[model samples]
Target chain A: MALSLAQASDVVDAALLKARELGLRPLVITVLDPGGHPVVIKREDGAGILRPQISHAKAWGCLGTGSGGAAGARHATRDPAFFAALAAISEGRIASSRGGALIRDKEGNLIGSIGVSGDRPENDEAVAVAGVESADLVADVG
Target chain B: MALSLAQASDVVDAALLKARELGLRPLVITVLDPGGHPVVIKREDGAGILRPQISHAKAWGCLGTGSGGAAGARHATRDPAFFAALAAISEGRIASSRGGALIRDKEGNLIGSIGVSGDRPENDEAVAVAGVESADLVADVG
Candidate 1:
């Protein structure tokens, strides 16, 4: 089954709650369905205007690379030019960052992705993982 | 107040329901916040692959012009050159079509917009209007 809108909202809400509990800064979160289309997006009141764009890019990168954002960053490092070109082609919707994680169903089927932006890359990543787990879904951070 | 994720999902669901009731073909719908940022997007099974892109473009056009998609099309008709340049500048994220409608709050404040694709332009706009009203929001289709 595809990732439902309700599930996507839950993921964003759980991610925001985790960020608040951790005392992280305002954040923007985006969840994309398996088809790489946004299912839900939330930008906290104080989040930077660019946060939404960055969060979406991270999630799109995860979907495109078939891996989490961190892994996409590593892949970019090995071929920066290619990735850079890809970003241009995609209108900057591909990010090589550490704040995106793959979402999977109980059977380990890739369903979608969650992307967070605001705090340090590691903190963003941590919150994204927490958010995924809170929804009883698998987070493939690897 | 900003459009919440719940509201966005509700709009999508309502739109899909209306499409079903009308016996229209598969559709893709997109909702964008006031800032022209995506809130949610849904593509029904069997929709064309390009439906999402078209839906987003229609919503973005409405947001950019501060008018519904039908109005934007009229504007384009008056100045095709300008609209074409705008499409190029936006990297195809703006469409001059009739499948988009402005979303407003009870006080008539511009909140966001919804765009639907799949059926004829008029049919798409009709379903979008039904969906927005179903969510207890105003639809500016003129």
Candidate 2:
């Protein structure tokens, strides 16, 4: 399903709210389209300066591979060589790590992805998940 | 006091090395000229797919503003009016934040910049500083 810009923005806002509710420090969050282009982004005050770039890169990784965090996990796992090449080719707009997640619509169609940075990997993932669920989208955890 | 390509490459090498030494996993490191043009880059295997883009954008922010991390820190300060315009004007490429450092010669000449991502912001910034020092250049921290 085609992802609306509104949905993307909502997802990001929800994620930011959840982060605040949890008393987590600020974060940089980004949502990318299916083609790996940025759709929306938010940066919390007191978050690091590099967060927006990092978050966009992570979301790009998810969109580029269409596989979400699994792709980042693999880069951290079995495929170091290929991952490096991918980084070079993409010109540094992608990051495969624990901070990214895929966004899908209610019909189980891929919509886009959300990426978060400025925290622990697991915490980043949690914020993204919370953000998606808050937007009322089915964030496929599996 | 232009940074020679060799020096820039060395900066990238040292940044990547430091990232590994810190057990921060693989990273994508990039060095750019004062013009925000890339001079050299090195991506560690398994660094994630979008690292290169993030690195480039981070470097671009430094080059564009010529202030290293000042732009990033400004946004993180959360003056919403300024950040909103920044985000709009940057076309999603301007990311003013930590993890980037302006490269200057001993005489305080603006030469280039160093940027790192794919790890924590603190780790990323540390590696970037190491890179600038490795090239015998001053980091624009002040």
Candidate 3:
């Protein structure tokens, strides 16, 4: 795992802290390694039952497309057929939204990504960015 | 919804602490609410690629059988066909192993469960017991 658990934990912690500051709804946050496997996941007590899967899907989109969820949303709009096919291929594990971003190191290397759910898309994206920056890494929100 | 993220986080922390003390292989620990939904999951950096799913499966067995994973193993041994059918029914999400236990409050009420993967089943179960106790809960290993 190129992305250590400590780093992934930090990302999730920062994201949760940001969510608290913004007074957003409870969230489920997931951090995925570059290989698209989950490293850490934390769901707030009141998060919807499905938020965990949604969180994973948001990040899965970024991993599969080499683009952030925002970019995924754009692609979905520009190529709806392709994006729909992707959803079917991944068995509904990819989604287009604003709550996901690729984590990049100082050297511009992809390490992982963070995905958040349970708030407005923009707020979710904001929290994800906070997480990456808190770890001293760049967030490629695409 | 009876399990809070704090409790689940503590379970993962204590399990990891136990794993470190034993010098065991890296592990993936999963805490699932009684409803069989994941509340927290942590995969160590060097844990096997399939550990997350295995951890979840171990916990799922506990939730589905209304008994600990050890009981599931016993049932598997006593009635292989029944257990095999169970595995097929859940789409391979239920497993018989020693690393899963139902978590109960001091009053013997069910709360959630903790599952661990990476080391031998006994070692994994030991770490899970440590985690449940650390959270001031009892381990119902069945």
Candidate 4:
């Protein structure tokens, strides 16, 4: 099943609200569809001007690397040439760094991805995961 | 001096290479000039295609906000109303999110920005810094 834009936006809103309730300060949130395309993004107030881009980057990284955003770095470290080739083949679309996660179903099918930025990497992960969980989607995070 | 497309490509290449070496996966790397315009971008093979756009969005976000990149998100949080207005005025040019940073000179002059996507917020920051360091440019990460 594909994720609708409304659903994606709702997920982002839920995640941001959760972050605020937890006093996590402003955040950069993004949601991607099953193909890793951004559906919508929202930057919290005081989150900074760079937050939106950062959030999109993280989400894109997760979708590109096919793993949680933060884990992309670890994947790259395990294989350099392969990573380079991957980057090359993707036409500079794949990244393995941080602040992102793969969205999945309970059956383990890759559904989509979500990424958060503008705060601690761990915190970013938390907010993203919260959105996924709230959406009743399984978040494959490490 | 404006950064050439080749220079932007080099910045992204170096950043991705370093990120791979660091064992991080899921990163999106982007390079921009002093005007916060995209010069080059590489998304990695497995990285989602959306990463490239996210990188661009982050750089534009910084330029629109006049807060460089790092501090933009924080500013967004403190002044949501103003930020919203700015975002509206910029027509989605300003982001004020995470995963973006301002490129600086040794003298702390803002040269441009480097935005990283597909990773956790902090991890993205690290990779962006690596890209700038690879180019031997100064960076104000805020």
Best by TM-score: 3
For model 4, how does the per-residue alpha-carbon lDDT over A1-142 read when each residue is reduced to its tens digit? 5577877877888898889877887887878776757788888788888777667766666665466765676766864433443443344455555668887877877767788877777787888888888988877765
| Model 3 bad stretches (over 4 Å) | none
Q: How much is A89 displaced in model 2, in angstroms?
A: 16
lDDT comparing candidate 4 with the true structure: 0.70
Worst 10 residues of 1 chain A by lDDT: A38-47
C-alpha RMSD (angstroms) for model 4: 13.2
The worst-scoring run of ten residues by lDDT in candidate 3 chain A lies at A1-10
Report residue A38 deviation for candidate 1 (angstroms): 3.5
True contacts kept of each: 0.29, 0.05, 0.85, 0.22
The lDDT per prediction is 0.86, 0.74, 0.90, 0.70
Candidate that beats the other on DockQ, 1 or 4, i.e. the better one: 1
Tens-digit lDDT track for model 2 on A1-142? Answer: 4468898888888898888888887899998776677788889999998889989877777765446775567654664433543454465666768888888888777778788998888888899999898888866433
| Best of the candidates, lDDT | 3
Candidate 1: residue B40 lDDT (0-100):
67
Candidate 2 lDDT tens digits, B29-64: 888887777789887864544566666666776776
What TM-score does chain B alone reach in each candidate, compared with the true chain B? 0.95, 0.89, 0.97, 0.83
TM-score of chain A of each: 0.95, 0.90, 0.97, 0.80
Per-residue CA lDDT of candidate 3, range B10-111, in tens?
A: 989988988999999999999999888889999998898899999999988898989998888888899999988998999998988889999998888888
For candidate 3, the per-residue lDDT at B27 reads 96
